[model samples]
Target: MTIRLAAVAAPFGRDLDECFATIERLAFRARSEGASVLALPEACLGGYLANLGGEAAGPPALRRDGPELARLAGIAGDMVICAGYCEAEGDLRFNSVVCVTGDGILGHHRKVHQPLRENQSYAAGDGFTAFDTPAGRMGMMICYDKAFPESARSLALDGAQIVVCVSAWPASRTDPAPDLADDRWTRRFDLFDQARALENQVVWVSSNQSGTFGDLRFVGRAKIVGPGGEILAATGVSAGVAVASLDLEETLATARRSMGHLRDRRPEAYAAGF
Candidate 1:
């Protein structure tokens, strides 16, 4: 089915009310543009960590069944919205994402891969899974998860036609590039988005935090990439929404017609590491 998808790149801080306002504004904009699915940046609800250091306290931990997510679902209305927040489970907190519509929650994903001092703040997730949504069969991941090919691959193997990766990725700390576009981390961010989509032959939606947050400077390059690794819509290095329209079945058919990446996978060939 044909669907309009929007990936967001905007700044979100520690304030929940302010973040909801931003999400409401952006959701309205996307809905007006006929978007069926909207992907918000990682930690867009309560904000990401000030730094990768273990010293800083984490964002407010929210429950999946709490009023915050319920409010988010109400704001979502008919549109499928994917957003990140700190998930609370008793004394432990997890870096997680949730997909919801006006009716209720559809899917949830806890970020499986932790980078640097992230493990110090939150417990790690154990697996990757795909679930059905109004838009299509979808999967989610956060920040550093996209770096590993296995993450996206696992989703695709689980029947995800589209993958949304929300991030709070920042530019390099040492020897930072004068131009954000030339920054190595920014380049890696873009490369991972394209490479994951191309290798798995799935539609890729990448959303990231924009502007500086405490000690880290985020690279806003939100984009919708086609299964062929072509960028359909991108916000470049600024805060904005990248929107695109395409027929999921047709797009996947076109990309997989000749040499299907999933069809030709040699899982048996690589038994040592995987």
Candidate 2:
């Protein structure tokens, strides 16, 4: 059976109420379009802070069991939704993503890599993992997590057939791009999506925030990548949704048929230091 999937590139600003409202509208649209799975950007529930500095960079911290995520899950009924947010566990905050269905949360993954002074604002998660859901076996990763090859590889080894990477990824922070699409950061983002999908032979769904926030201008290139590293659908440099259909089992079988990257392992031969 083929199931429709969508990755959204849209804006969700500072206000909690407004953010939820935007998510609702998008969820309604996805349902109408027959999307069985939806992926939203990192920190989509609250605006990403302008700077990761003392006192100024704190985005609103929400608990995993909080009303916010519950409200998101309410809209998620049937359609599996993977979305990013700032997670508050006691006093520590972590950049995180949660996957939900009508039933409830299937998995929650905290952003494992802290870029620049991102560690100044959020605590780091320990590792990577994949989980089971109504849709299929899947893994979740936040923005910076996808930069590392091991992040996706670990999930693949854990039996994940599909990996959802949600980001609040912005255009070049230093040398700003005249066009968001031409930015080096945007290019790297696309490359990572394709490499991760092909290397692991897993379906990749990439979603990001669109428009500008504080000093940042996000590159909205949300896409659905096939196991062969081909883009099935994409929303180029704009606030839009990228949709594609995948016959889960068959797709995986075909991608791994001739040369299974995971099966042809050389983990023992490679040095730990890259």
The regions of model 2 sitting more than 4 angstroms off are 54-57, 272-274
CA RMSD (A), model 2: 1.3
Cα TM-score per model: 0.98, 0.97
Candidate models: Cα lDDT each: 0.95, 0.91
Q: Encode model 1's per-residue lDDT on 1-274: one tens digit a residue.
A: 7899999999999999999999999999999999999999999999999988874677989999999999999999999999999999998899999999999999999998998988889999998999999788999999899999999999999999999999999999997899998999999999999999999999999999999998999999999999999999999888999999999999999999999999998878998778
CA deviation > 4 Å runs, candidate 1: none
Q: Give lDDT tens digits, candidate 2, residues 207-260.
A: 999998877789999999999999999999899999999899999999999999
Q: Residue 147, candidate 1: how far off, in angstroms?
A: 0.5
Model 2: weakest 10-residue lDDT segment is: 49-58
Report the number of clashing residue pairs per model: 0, 0
